[model samples]
Target: MRGFSLLDSSGLPVAKTCFDPANIPEALHLDVWRQASRCGAQVDSLQRDWRFRGRTSNWYTDGVVFSHTLCDATHYQRTPRHIRRGDSDCLVLKLQLAGHQQGIFGDFDHFSSPPGTLVLQDWAIPYNITTTPYEVMAVSIPRYLLRGSHLMYRRNPVITWQPDSPQARLLVPILTQTLKSLATASAGEADAYAAGITGLLDGLLLGDRELLQSKYRERDRLEDMRQYLSRHLSDPDLGADHLCRQFHCSRATVYRLFQREGGIATFILRQRLQRCMQEISRMGVVQKGFLEALAHTWGFSSRANLARHFKAYYGITPQQAVEAARSHQNEGQREMNAPYWRDAHRVSRWLESIAPGASPTEPAGAHGGTRQGPRELAGH
Candidate 1:
């Protein structure tokens, strides 16, 4: 695939391309795969042995991109930084095949995706995905395509559709067949397939778009308030009153929006407490008084205040939490010098190696292990 005429045998500019991790050295396998999966998405190896096999057959056609990817154990994350609100927006759809992907995606916390689930993601929202060695078919559609049907782009960035639903039975097959068609179809045919999929999708979306519009409008406002609380956790005036003015909503309205989260005060407390916990997990209370310091920084009056709420929320005391974190930290310290995790320069080079670039013949890909990248990641 390194011949780099965009890697399409037909030389189509809106070309189909593929990536395999084997083109690079074994040590940088995870790094390059992360780079190609989604720009800025962080990839972590679940296993120290790194049974990493990420092969992607991707096609760009008519405002949509379809990809079929299979991989081994890995954790992928797109954090807040990947939420590009003003950019050319995209919604990614993941139709699970052989394996399950479980993680927190936007507001849907602690989700375990089942097989045949269609997960739609707004690129503006962050997601964390951990997958087993499994097969997945994904489609990336631009936001404008849905806008034609009155779908709110940012309302539900992460939403799952079960395959057994009435709507899913109708829409899921079209989505699946159209995405798979990209692998074998030529440029003209693939583009038409993509357009056809989008058209049919728009019709389905149109049926519900009008109904979801207002519901999403309310969700968007709630999301805005949540974002505000995250950025201003330490601010003294960070409560329902502040949110009311900041977002120009009534006190009653603010309460109504967060009714599911136990009202405005609880949401703020949870955000502050969440950050405090993350700090403890990452650093494990380095100093004697760091626990109190962490509490104060997050607006807790004292260590006792944080401990009381933390125990209520997580069923553990602050000291106990630190002890657990320390245990995990000590375990990771052993791998701090391991070869598979070493050599930043080599990883950078391999990450840089993914150019707009395979042979065309591996029905299973070029070599063993699904496919190979650069030289061998060709679309057959």
Candidate 2:
């Protein structure tokens, strides 16, 4: 479906469109990226067999937040270089409606949630998400709304609520229903609905309030350190000693707070590399001298140093990234006005081959050693 929209009886705009990659003209199969970007998200890469069907609805309360339900795709989603450069901050609360997902949250901490599980992901941090034909409802909440709510604490990037739990049982249905109502909710009604959802989240997450309350002081100090780091990411001199002196804390305390992000020095380097990556992507395939200057601007010792570290972290050289970006840009421009179902025939064949009992050749490592079956779509 395309160009589909919905509005309330009062004429309030609701959903902008309802689309399914499978039936859409041009068959671009970029629905995953399209829907994600609509909700202020970016994808590092999508599954080769990537196909998506989803709807997005908008709501306004204290601020505008959107709800999205995506189904039938597996991909890695993250804060892209451009989005991160703009300092985008939000929290995505995901309710797994079906299938399974496994990924890393924050710098460490791996998570695998099955169907019916609820998880909270911080948009400020990059994540590597891998899912198999899953349907998930993602509610985008502004970071400021969640600040100081125990949800913002650095140590809790990914919080999971089991579906069978009492809190999940009570809150999940309510949250899902609220999202559904957003499609045609009046402004006043939307505000009340938003408030209700917020209250439920606060109650669910803070139910074990004492545990977070006990570490309030520690969380405060960590936030302070994190703010300081953010302000001075380009400062090569920023290190453990600098933090200790600035925050008036012991070296041990500084280490403990950042231990999950690797030590203080490692964290700083990672931040610098991240900044460099953003710059490189923005610059595209540019002159070597310009690229080197860009690296120096981000506080790297030299372009060589940037190249080595960037490859290690991103698994791609700076030049390669530039080339890829340029190539993607050129291809996008060429297809700018092409039909949406340009490759419909190819997609149709692939889909057919993966139907029940079909022995389609599976892409190596696509399932990470899991057995292939009809349910598992083959990646090109």
**Predicted structure 1: lDDT:** 0.58
TM-score for each model? 0.55, 0.51
* Cand. 2 Cα-lDDT: 0.54
lDDT per model vs. reference: 0.58, 0.54
| TM value for model 1 | 0.55
Please give the distance, in angstroms, between residue 377's alpha carbon in candidate 1 and its true position after superposition.
16
Clash statistics: count for each candidate:
4, 8
- lDDT score for residue 187 of model 1: 60
Residue-by-residue lDDT tens digits, candidate 1, 1-380:
11112223564434555555554455545454554554536665544445346655566554455777776655566667554423224556678887777655564333456788877665555666656666788766554444332243345445567889655787678777876666566666765666666656556656765655655557667777888877888874689888878888799999888886667787777677667755664572489899888888998878898899877755557676666445332232223343333322223222223221111111111232221132222232
Q: After superposition, how far is residue 97 of candidate 1 from its true place, in Å?
A: 1.1
